[model samples]
Target chain A: MTLTKRIIPCLDVKNGRVVKGLNFESIKDAGDPVELAAKYSNEGADELVFLDITASDEQRATIKELVRKVASVINIPFTVGGGVKSIDDARNILLNGADKVGVNTAAIKNPPIITELMTLFGRQCIVVAIDAKRNYDLKENVNIFSENEKKFWFEVFIFGGKQGTGIDAIFWAKEAEKLGAGEILLTSIDADGTKNGYDVLLTKSIVDNACIPVIASGGCGKPDDMVEIFEKSNVDAALAASIFHYETHGVKGVKSFLKEKKIPVRL
Target chain B: MVSVAIFDYGAGNIFSLKNSLEQAGASVDVITSFDKPNIYSGLLLPGVGNFDPAIKSINENSKTKFQDFVEEDTPVLGICLGMEMFFEKSEEGIEKGFNVIDGEIVVLPSTMKVPHMGWNNLEIKKPGTILEGVDDGSWVYFIHSYRAKPKFDDVITAESDYGVKVPAVVEKNNFFGTQFHPEKSGDIGKIMIQNFLNVCKK
Candidate 1:
């Protein structure tokens, strides 16, 4: 019962440099991914996530090199995602030093890829990243987490949130888990880059539906937002980019604040 | 010098583990098999993947040789899935483990998450070299679904709470297995790896 709540800082990489955006657009450079990764690792970030935002096949080597550089510099668990399209791509990233490979579009395109990666590598290394937005049109069919007073249902998105799959996020989480994804990296596009706070309703919905460990991402503004989402949901970890990228509060600062708030975080 | 050979099962990430080991002042080698295991002072069974594929790869390639290596009294450390393979058998896979320790690997209770993934504090159960310089309640990174329950409690060096006393570290004779990933664990993990190097030196 004392499993420590994890604080993860995500580095969205574009052309080997760390980038940040508002609602997954309007990109701004943060810094070097390797340097930022080492800084986060030393700052008590529980885990580091590197998302390759570039979609070009030519930038594959850059992503691999970035993974190697960052992995060599940091000692914590690092998960790499973004352009990973196949099992071989996952293997290449992992071999370059990533502990886990995150698949978003590819997984939605071929659901069996999750199982294939899990069977080939292991369930522990396959993290299915679900980019989702709130869909107000869907009628509520699942009453499990209906207590939340949100007007919309969660919908799954792919292609870096550009193309909406119209898939129910909660149901997709359950299927992804069954397909052998060890963890769910759930990012709420509605709250992403807004700094308003995490979509706790969306997060808790997935947490209630899926048995695997879920990492809540997007819209983490400050330490209190983390506290609120963690209190509201059973997410194993919370991921933020802007707060850490902008130095609004560092990983250690957030962990200390959470620790002060009686949250069980590794300080 | 502390010499260690990390067994390569052709799955999982070994780069960070190797980097951490070298950082801890040990000369490390990634060996495909356990052939001539006596040459290294310590052998590392790094964790990753499932019990069946990993065990199949190990058994098909280095089963008898690894048995001899374990019997040689050389320090052998198994990590995560690597640790699960030290048991008689695991619920995760149908293959029988090396059975270096008397135990069965069972899935974590349903109340807890399946992977039990995250950082959790350790409760040091006994005095062991692996816990040297590491605080009794220091946190370590854990990403595992199944854990080993050695029949003898004395083998448990540390346990982490996950709605149950999940064994974090187990040791018998020169054999050591950690349910957590010491390589990915930060400062405390570095200390534990250094302590293992010291054990090899001794």
Candidate 2:
């Protein structure tokens, strides 16, 4: 089999501890990163991704230590991302046993960073993270966008979906693929932390357009949400942070649910 | 100690499989070279990614050694691409396989989606040691687009439905294969690995 549907548990780390937020607010420390990672690993997480969401300058050393600690216990593949800007940063994380390095802001600032990292460490090592929000024109009350007329645009955002770049999400996804990114972590800001469900239409737009694997992130409240994402979006993996970290749904619980739904997750 | 050699071609999920087998009461060694196969009580050929490069690497690095090792009727398990490599040839890149099994790997029809990623039910065709405790219609995780069409149907120990009779497990004496990721398949998968190690003990 060329590609398997990955069941990924995302850890949003701040100061070496797992944390979660509601709509990017009300941040609260969940638990120790290492302890949480071991728990998820035992629960059947196919892979774990730790996002150092804290600002870059303050937690560089702490994040490195956290990555090392998490890698020490978990045998499955783990990815470290967020605030990764330079090759040295990527090198340090991979040296700490991170199977992959996910780049977001750096990739947006200089798209060549994707190609550079891929050239240095192979295409399989680089994952470009895209956090997008669906733009709906209130006048039309529709999610559709018009490009050439310079009206109604589904613009892509950067810097944790706080800044809109007026770039279409579809365009950037295709461009990221062409730039040699191994995979795409597409998160919908519109549905993020809402726990309603994934932005299926937006996810499908990117998955349908791109040839590489697309990981659907955000808005996962339950295991069935994952089944819905895989069954409908054609995405290769589903990533959730709060649901797994808060013990709302264990990895084994999610895998069992998916298996029953015929969604094929690593049990 | 039940020594198990897990063949690593730099493509398969080596770490997870090693962890599972080690948990199943086996002293597992991840091997990239074919120089020594007799050190282990059994062999596991695990693979991921495309078939062409995987076959090329295995043949150039460990094919002859594997041939000699398989001659002894030692228990061997192939997972996913590893299973595809056992066939005579695969439609993917039209590459020639190990030819241990008189079968050909063909891609599933595109109308039903290419990768066929996810979990499905296994229909046991023949009971054997490898599937010692696995239920006949138990659900196992699967992630492949192409499947082996064994020249003889009797070789298939278990089959799964994905718009087709996909081979989930195949066994012939000491030779066995799994089209699903037993390492990723959770408790049931762990049991399956334990059963394979039980075979090694005998």
Candidate 3:
């Protein structure tokens, strides 16, 4: 197939401004969502993801307006995830112009909502965001994978990757797909914020098991990290935060690097 | 100023499509049904929602009006499910299509994933219409599980290899269709939309 691998920039937003993390309320604002989104779209980034870590329901309305502003400025595809709790939430974001609605804790808390979202908004527009962490407390009857002699199963996390759910990430991915999830956004809690590289072993395992397109998220520090993941896994796309947020590299520069590495990108 | 009407299937995807068209220098109006008089210069069938429901939505209010638009050559462009609906039938849904194209929509081979999603290059066959000024192998964004198999291959102006030769772009007289979403297809897609607007201007 002539399909090229995608490079997606993840923006963490709160109260209409892009932020670095949820805990850093005092950290300086990263950028405007609409402006950053437009910059990424113009720089050849294939797609974008906006994660609203804001916990308050009162301010959620602002996120939809933010989505509208970004959608107006950019032409590429974007997925918006701001604690999508119900069909109404997904509908609000989608109606505001988000191409796909990403559900994380909602899907974990009520698995049936996956099928419900899929039925209401076609499978293509539903994204099941799975924030999985490597749980070393080896449990029985779980899909176990290991690295460096450490045997563990990737456990699904909810509440913005703070709480662990005993559910196996690998098994949950298949369940999500069977439950009508159009795509899976697989994030490694252990790899996130590390800025070393992607957890290729974890990403590759999920990619191999799921027939749906998987986006490998977290742990991207440099262009080489992206190169390593694409070279290692069959994942359709790679999502990064700090690299783009911190201005380490532009989306165009990353794509040029990927193209040079013989990895197919939109550029 | 030229105006384009986007036939909203209520799939919540018209936002970017509207933005891209506006960026391409065309005023846009979102129309949910064709029962109303066609006021726009060009009509666009957006690619969103399930096949059956979208067809049902169209057949519910304005089937004949849409057919007339296609038959009389009013310059229409259908994207993804929009393009698939013009075929004779689809494996995704039991409802009959618009029959504008002599083809049937079928599931992509099991060898590949269900939804052929992402940016794939076009293997330009005989270029014109939306593919004008677009380079051969220019990438476009796509997200669909079903592909159309037209009875006449000549109607397919561009195709992409996905185990099967998936028709990427098709042009049959005043009617045009893309299996991929040009609005989501980055800079190259902008050019295609601008080209479609040029047709609308005429």
| Candidate closest to the true structure, highest DockQ | 1
Pick by TM-score: 1 or 2, better one: 1
Per-model lDDT: 0.88, 0.77, 0.88
Question: RMSD in angstroms, all models?
Answer: 1.9, 5.6, 1.7
Off by over 4 Å in 2: A1-8, A22-27, A38-49, A52-129, A135-143, A146-151, A158-167, A171-184, A195-197, A207-215, A220-238, A247-267
lDDT of 3 by residue, B49-144 (tens): 888988888778675657865456578999999899879999998998888889899999988976888989899999688988999988888998
**Per-residue lDDT of model 2, residues A1-267, tens digit only:** 123478888888877777887765678888888998889877778777888888667666777777766665665667789889898888778665576789988998999988877655545567889988756543332336544554453567788778977677788988988898777888888788899998787899889888767889989998878888988978988999888877677788888888888775544
Give the B-chain TM-score of model 1.
0.95
* Model 2 lDDT per residue over B1-202, tens place: 7999987765423555776777677898877777654777788987455677676667688646566876756788888888888889988756688778888999887556545555566778778666888877665666566888999998888888766888788887678899987776656787888888888888
Q: What ranking of all candidate models by TM-score puts the best one first?
A: 3, 1, 2
lDDT of 1 by residue, A77-132 (tens): 98999878888899998887899999999999999999999998889999999998
Model 2 scores a C-alpha lDDT of: 0.77
- Single-chain TM-score of chain A, each candidate: 0.95, 0.92, 0.96
lDDT value, residue A267 of candidate 2: 48
